[model samples]
Target: MRTFFNIAAFAAGSQALITRGDSCCFHLTASGGASGSVGQLSDGQNRIGDNSLSPAEFCINSGAITDGNGRGCILTPPTTQLQCDEGATPTGGFSIDSSGKLEFQGSSKFIACETGQNGGLNIYTTESSALSNCKPIELMADSCAAPKPQPTSTSTSTAVATSASTASATATAPATPPANNGCPTTLTSGNFEFPHLIVPIDSSSPDTAAGTQFNGKVTSTVSSIFNFDIPQSDSGKTCSLVFLFPKQADLQTSSFTFSGDGKIDFAALSGIATKSTTFHNAPSVSKDLGTIAVSPGNQYVVSTFSCPAGQTVSYEMKNAGSTSLEFFEDFNPSP
Candidate 1:
C-alpha cells in the first residue's frame, strides 16, 4: 500500500506513522538538516515504543508539515529528498494525500522510499516505487495500534526534570498546610545532562533509589516512572512542576549532546504516596493531560496541576527522552 501527503486534509497536530513489525520508532536527528537531506523527524509520524520518549511533535499546517523541533519541512532542490531545514528557505511547498497512490503533487512523478546502503530509508520525490524502473522500496508505513504496557514486577520509579536554570537550594514549601500536612510546594530533579549520565534506581539500590533516599536526586532518564515530593500549594490553588536542563553552553562545555528538543513531555499523575517505594509495584489510577509541547524559552519549563493536598505524587512519564523534571517557585514572566 502507498500513502501521499494531503496537506489540506491534515488537522492541526494530527498523529501519524509506525511501520508494522518494527519496534524502532523515529527520532528527529538532534541537529536537523545536518544529519540528512534535511532534518528528518517523523516526516508526519511519531511512534511510541517501549521505554521510548514521549511522542515528538508531528504537526500539520496548511503550508507544510513541521518536525518535532518546529522547523519547516522542505524539499532539497535538484534532489527529490525532503527534510526539515535549519534557517534554509524552502524550495517549494509539499502536498500530501492519503489516496494510497504514493503520488506527489499530482504528477507523473511519485513519492518513493529508497533504502540506502547504510540501511536507512530515504524519502524522495521522483518516480513511483511501483511505476518506474528506478524501482525504490515501497515502505507502506501504516498506522499501528500502540501495544499495552505489561506489569513491572520489580517496579522502579523516579524523575529528574530538565531545565536550563540554576536551581535554588531552598525548596518551596506547600502553602496553607492543614496544621500537620507536609506538602512541599517545590520539587527538583537530579543532574543527567545526557542520557548516558542517567543512573538507574531500584528498591535493591537505595543509594540510587528515590524511594529509599527521598532526598537523593529526584529524577532519572533511565526510567519512565517519576516520584516527586511536590511543591503543593494546597490552598485548592494550582501547583507547578519545574524542570531544568543544562543550557546549550553547559552542554557544550560538558561535551554532552542535547537530549530533548526542549519540548515538555506529558506526564500523567499516578499514585500518591507517603513513600515512593511503597507506591512502586502497586497498581493505581492515573490522570491524563492532552497533547501539548512545553515552551522552554523561559529558562525553565513549568507544568501546573491540581495540588494533591498533603501527598507526594508520582508522575508516570512514559518516555526516556523526557528530561528529569523539577519544580520551581514560580514561572518566569519574561522569556
Candidate 2:
C-alpha cells in the first residue's frame, strides 16, 4: 500500500526543513515564507530553499515531519519531499516549494539519482496538466550491506557500439569560419554526436599550439561516450577546440587540449591524413599529432554514456562529415 504524509502550516511566512530518513517515498507541499521565499524538505538529511525562500532561521533538533518526506519542515506552498531505502536498486526523493518550483533530492551515500520518475516519487511544476513540468529523479544503489547473492553471468553485450576498422578517408577540407546552420544552442538528441580523439600537441610554443603542454608531456585525452537522444532532429555535426593548462613544469600537472567545444579530428585520432595544419604562438613543447580511430557508435554508450550491462543498443552520428578515418574499439556490456 502507498503511504500518505501529513504536513502542518506554521506561521503564514515561516519556513520548513527536510532531513535524511529511511522510507519508501513521500509527497509534500507547503506555503508561506519571505515574499519570494520558498522552502522544502526530503528524507531527514537535507534542508533546502531557492530564490523564493531561504533556509530556516530558527532552531529545531528534528524539525517538522508534516506534509513532506517523513521528517521535513516546510516554509513555502511549493514544498514537497520523499525518501526511501537503498534496497539493491536506487530511488529518488522530491520537493516542491510555495512558488510552484519543484526540486529533486537524492542520497549520495546510499543511491545515485535520476531526473525522472520510474524509480519512485514524482513532482509537478504547475497545477494544470498542460502546464505541468514534472520530472522524475531516479536513484540507484550500487552498494548495500544487505546480502542477496544473485547469479553472475559472463555473457557480455555492447555497453555502447564499438567498431574495429581502419578508416582510409581523410579530412581534405580546410577549416571554415562558423556560420549559422540552424545548430541548436543546446546539444540534445538528433544532433551530430560529439567526436572524440587524441591529438599530439607541442608545448615549447604556448601561443601557437592547438593545446598546452609541460615538460616532456603535453596534450590530454578528452573523451566521453554520450547519448544523443533529443526528440527534435537536425543536420550534420561540426566541432571546434578549447584548451586548459597549468603554470609550472609538471607533466602530470600541466596539460593541453582542443579548442572550444572542440571535436577530436577522427583523421587525427586515426593518425592518417590532414587537410590544413597551423601553429600560432609558443614557449612550450610541440610535435607531430597523434592517431585516431572509430568504434561502434554504441561504444559511445559504454565509454561515454551510462547504461545497464548486457543491454542491446545502437547509436549513429547525424549529419557526419564525408571524411572517413581509422578507429580503435572495445564493447563489453554489463550483465
lDDT of each: 0.30, 0.20
Count: clashes, candidate 1 = 27
Where is model 1 more than 4 Å wrong at Cα?
1-221, 224-226, 230-233, 248-265, 273-285, 289-302, 318-335
lDDT of 1 by residue, 159-278 (tens): 222222222111222212111111121232222221111122343444343442211122333323444443333334333333333333433222223333222333444554323343
Name the 10 consecutive residues with the lowest summed lDDT in model 1: 1-10
lDDT of 2 by residue, 1-335 (tens): 00000111111222221211222223222232212221332332222223223332211111112322223332222222232222211111222222323333211111122223322222222233332333333222111111112222321211111111111110000112222111111111111212222122322342333331111111232211111121111112221111111221322222222222111222111121111211222112121111111122211100111111222221111111222222222221111
| Total backbone collisions, model 2 | 88
Please identify model 2 stretches exceeding 4 Å from their true place. Answer: 1-198, 205-335
TM agreement with the true structure for every prediction: 0.28, 0.18
